[model samples]
Structure formats: C-alpha cells, structure tokens
Target chain A: MAGIFKVKAKAKDGVTKVKMLAKHVMETGQRKDKKTGEIIPAKFIQEITVQHAGNTVFSGQLGTAMSKNPYFSFTFTGGAKGEELSISWTENTGASATETAKIK
Target chain B: MTMHRRTVVKAMLACGALVGLGAVIPGAAFAARNKDAFSSDDQAKAMQALFDAEPANSQDIVLKAPSIAENGAVVPVTVSTEMTGVESISIFVADNPTPLVAEFMIPAGTKASVATRIRMGKTSTITAVVKADGKLFSTARETKVTIGGCGG
Candidate 1:
C-alpha cells in the first residue's frame, strides 16, 4: 500500500538532508465529535523510522500533542545520489505504512 | 576551549566504548516506546516510565523554546547537542495533561538535533532529556502559554 508521506532527500557536501510531510488526522482524544458529542479517540502516528541503504538512520516516537499532518526534517552523514531511503510510520491504532525515496 | 575539547574527547571515548558494547546486545540502539508515559498526567510518573531513572542536569544539550508561547497548540521546540553516541532525545511538558510529548532516536553518524512542535495545556516547564552512551542528561525551561492547547 502507498503510504501518505512525501519525502525528499538531497545529498550535498557529504551530508544528506531529509524533509518529509505526513498526511494524518492526528485526532486528539479530547475533542468531542460534533454529532455524537463523545470524545474522539486519539489517533496519531506513534513511531517513525528512517533507513538508508539498509541501515537505520533516524527514529522517533510521537504523541497526540503533534499537529495534524506532522512535518519532520533532519540531516545525516553518509548518503549518496540515487541511494535508497525508506520511511515507515506506525500509528496508535496499529496501522503502519512505509514509503521510499531516492537520494538526489 | 582546550578544557572543553578535552571533556568532549573523554565523553566521545566513553560513548565509543558503550556503542561497542551495545552492538553486542540486540535492540540496544533503541528504547521501547513508553505508552504509559505519554498518557500520564504526572511529571514524575512520566519521567520514571520514560527513563526508569531521574536525569542529571547537563550543560551539553541545547534546548530552544519560546519564553512565552503565543499559541500552545504549536509551540516550536528544537533540541541539539554535540555529544557523540546520542541514543535518544525526549521532550516533556510538566503541566500538560500528558506530560511526555515525544522521543527521538538518533542513529550513529547522525547529528544530535531535532525539531518539532508540541502542545502545552498551560504554562509549563518544558524539559528536554538526552540519553547518550547510557547516561541520561536533561535541561528544562519554562514557557508561558497564552492560549491553552490540547482542547483547553
């Protein structure tokens, strides 16, 4: 399945900079459903992992405090043009998705 | 400057040794996510669940956060450190309904820096904790939230 993430990696000066935008509702449990008036259960991406050339480069755990459609950016050493980079995320609901990009 | 370099070198050597040891133990580069900490309203409980021990104050980590957040819903936070072998970095808000905001794992050769936004329920002490070479270090700063976030 295609994950809802847009990633771009650019290698320059021996460093690779990565930027990503994820499409998610990031529903905070405190919000009440407009119709039902019941709290909307929290649903958010709880974990994210990034790999390059089969090696883990970055990972993070998130919570409901993050804004909707979270944006993330980071830089790491040792990346080359055309290298494979993958990002995978797991949500609180146990759903996960992975997307891949090629370093430029 | 020389003293600082010496300290950094010593720290790096210590980290190098620890990283070697971690390689021998599977899953040592990462820490399990603490769901309870994210759901906790108590700061102490959240800290315990996340680190299993109190973090020591440190001058190494640089935590940048607003002194007064005009909007608590999207308070920008950035954490950076020069410490090598940085295993992870975590953010926490003392007064939030759920104190623990996020945790990030920094792999080897990656810069120990991360930027993100977090919600603040009210005026709070925002803490940034860094785990480097199996040692926990932290720094905290107070930020006044003008508009409550997290559904007020």
Candidate 2:
C-alpha cells in the first residue's frame, strides 16, 4: 500500500539503486513538551529491511539518534525491471508494516 | 495494549494464510537484538555490544560528513568503503548521549555504501565502522554543530 514509506528504485547495467523516505516521529524520549514539561516516551524504528527475490539487499538497526522522517539510499546487484522489492520495518513501540515497490 | 495484541495476532494470521511466504523474510534475519547497544551511551561499550570487537583504523573506510552543520536535527552522513565482503556498516556520534546512531547490514550483492540522516546533540566526532571478512575497520570525522538538536 506504500503507507508510511515512499520508494524509488531503478535498475541499470545489473545494478539497482533504491532510495526511500519513511515517515516517523523518532522521538528520543529526551525532548520535553513546552506546555506541560513532560518527557516524551522513546519511539523510533528499530529495524528496517529490504528484500528482492527472497534475498535481503539492505537492513538497518536504528536508534533514537536517527532524524525524524528517515531517508536512506543504497544499491544492489541482480535486480531486474518490474521486479518488486519488499520492505518491512519494526518500531520500538511494537508496531510494524510491510510495503512493496516495483523496480523501474 | 490488549487491543494492540489482538490486532497483531489478526495480522499474523492474515500474513501466514494468504501470502506464499516466498519473499517474506523472517524478522530473525535482521532483528533488532541491539536495544542495549543503542542505549549504551558510551562509544567503546556500544561498539563492543554491536560488533564485539575493537575496530582497527583504516583509510579504505570513507566517512563523509559536513565540517560544519547548520542544523543538528538533520545532518546527512554517508559511509563508503572499497573493501569487499562487507558484513555491516555502523554509525556513531561520539558526543551524543547514546553514541551509537545506526547499524546497517550489507548483504553479499549489495554495495558497501550507505547514506542517511542523524541527530547530533552538539559538535562531535562521528565514526563509521565497517565489518568485512570477520574484521572491523573504522574512520572518523569531526562535525561542528551550530545548534544543539537534543534539548536536555
């Protein structure tokens, strides 16, 4: 469904470049609200992985130090046109989602 | 949290029943078992928890970052290496409360290059550690932060 993640992937000369942007608050649990002065609970993407043809291309384990709305780019070999890259992520709060994109 | 657990169970059932399980990679393959590493705060201990080894400084590992960052909330960092058989690439901000920022696993066919954004509390030395062929190599660069990102 492409929810929470936007991806652009293209393959050329046996190399595929994939770039994605994820919508996340990435609260570090250190920031305090101006009005209430209450500390925000820590919440962020703990793990993210991308796979093609049943093989993992890239995987990341993140911390609260990552910026909000995380963006990432990497390249892998052997992907082809019209193939789908499956992305899945799990956050610290236990929420997770899986999405797919077609390689151009 | 009861409602959340029920929803998760429902989703698991749906995923197990309908999908062919072809491309559905198991979470264990790249699971987040480094919660302690993420919260270690100390760079040396965090590195030990993450890689379980002391990284040897290497010039082959290239870490690119701004010499001066205008905003600490979002600083772009890139790590690349010419080394082959790269296992993973990890980012560390020495002065952050939690020094370890992120760790990326590079599969066999993937290139040893990664780019992402991170948060910095203030000016600090950022390091990129790469594990290749069962050995760790590292490089570091100093980034001057104009504004602190983490308000403590």
Candidate 3:
C-alpha cells in the first residue's frame, strides 16, 4: 500500500519531541480475497524502532489487529537543533521502510 | 394424600438442582452470549501470550471512543490510566479476527497515556490492558460499528 507518514519535531532545553504516522494495510490474514475466496496471509508491520543519534529511544511490536495507516507520537530525551532522527519499520513479510527527520 | 405432597417436593428439588447447576457452571447459561468475541481456542492462546494475564475489570482506566463509529476502517480510541507504577499499555478489539490489537511500552518516569485509531470489523468491546508494577490490570468499553467498514 502506498501512503504517507509525517514526523514533526521540536527542540526545547535539549529535549526533542517527535510524532509519526505511517500508512499500511495491516491485514490479519483472516480476511478472504473477494475473487479467489482464499484467505489473505497475515501481513503487517511487525516491529517499529526509532533512534536518535544512534541511541535507541523507542520501539514497539505491532500486530495485524492494528488499523490501516497507524500513527504514533513519542518524545525523546536529547537532541541538538539539527540532528537527524532515524525511524524504521519492518513488516512481517520482510518489507521495510525508513525515514529521517531533522530536529528543528 | 401424602404421596402427592411428596411428588411436589421432589419436583421442586429437581428445579432447585437445575438452577444451582446453571449458576455454578457458567458455560451452561451464557454459552450463546459468549459468542460476541474470542471464541476460538487458538485465538485465546495467542491473546494470552501477548500479556501475562487476562484482561480484568478496573475503575481507574478511562477508555474514550465514539459510541457509534461511522467508519469501521478507522475508529479512534484513547486510553488513559490513573494507576501508578504503570509498565505498559495495550488495546484489544474483541470482534476482530485477532483480538490482540496494539501494545505500548511505557518507560518509567513517563506518563501513561496512549491514543490511536483502530479498525473494527463490527460491534465489539474495546479493551485496555495496563501492566502496573508487574501485575496486569485492564478495562473495557463496548463500541458499536454501525457500517461494516472492514470490507463488508
């Protein structure tokens, strides 16, 4: 599924706050294909991790029960004014996507 | 004359026995009503593995969601807990194919708050699981999905 994710970050007193939204189908494998009448294999983002300056800040395990296009917001402890925050997700089927944001 | 009185007493005893059995064996009375969600053994096992314990009743957790969801594809849900020493927060949809919906890890010294949108296949109870200081606590609210937005 093609979708968009937005991340907004702000720095105050050396702390950086971040929020993210990602688009995905998150099929639970229980739903059947309309034409084939076969169950669709479960496909979802199994894991999501966020790192700031190579330090793991947040991570989560996701399941097929999540809605399409999940959105998450969180805060990290430290960041400079222009440092890069790396975000990535790995789907159960091996598909992965990553994005980077600069502290503002 | 005495035999008729004895027969009536025996019938009353039988009725009392049936009522007692129904009360003791929960399955006998509400098996049909239990079909709202979580019917399969495998699904139950999966839900169990995600959390240390089954969802329990709680008064401190507040779950916010629309009483009637217009869209099943995306139903917004917000959960907040007043319980102290919280470790994690999770959400589950009883009517979905997989009841274990989402889990959040709340690091120590952070506020225990989570808000998200979930997909509902139909009318179901939305559960919030809170793990506080190694013990599991939970609360639930019923949400009615008016339209079958999960590809009905």
Note the B-chain TM-score for every model: 0.77, 0.78, 0.68
- The complex in candidate 1 yields a DockQ of 0.41
Candidate 1 chain B — worst ten consecutive residues by lDDT sum? B22-31
Tens digit per residue, CA lDDT, model 3, B1-152: 89999999999999999976764465345442221222222435545656535766788998898889988878888888878887777777877766766677776544576667778888988888888978888888889998754562
Question: Runs in model 2 with CA error above 4 Å?
Answer: B1-32
Best by lDDT: 2
Tens-digit lDDT track of model 1 for B69-89: 998887888899999889999
lDDT of 3 by residue, A1-104 (tens): 33345777787886666667776778767778989998888777767777777766666666666678887765656787888888787787888887787888
Q: In what order do the candidates fall by DockQ, top score first?
A: 2, 1, 3
Index of the highest-TM-score prediction: 2
| Model 3 accuracy (lDDT, Cα) | 0.72
Instruction: Compute fnat per model.
Output: 0.67, 0.84, 0.42
Docking class of 3: incorrect
**Interface DockQ per candidate:** 0.41, 0.55, 0.21
C-alpha TM-scores of all predictions: 0.83, 0.86, 0.71
Give candidate 2's error at residue B56 in angstroms.
0.5
CAPRI-style grade of the A/B interface in model 2? medium
Whole-model Cα lDDT of every candidate shown, in order = 0.86, 0.91, 0.72
The alpha-carbon deviation from the true structure for residue B109 of candidate 2, after best TM-score superposition, in angstroms, is 0.2
lDDT of 2 by residue, B20-51 (tens): 35223332354446755777879998999788
The regions of model 3 sitting more than 4 angstroms off are A1-4, A12-17, A76-81, B1-47, B82-84
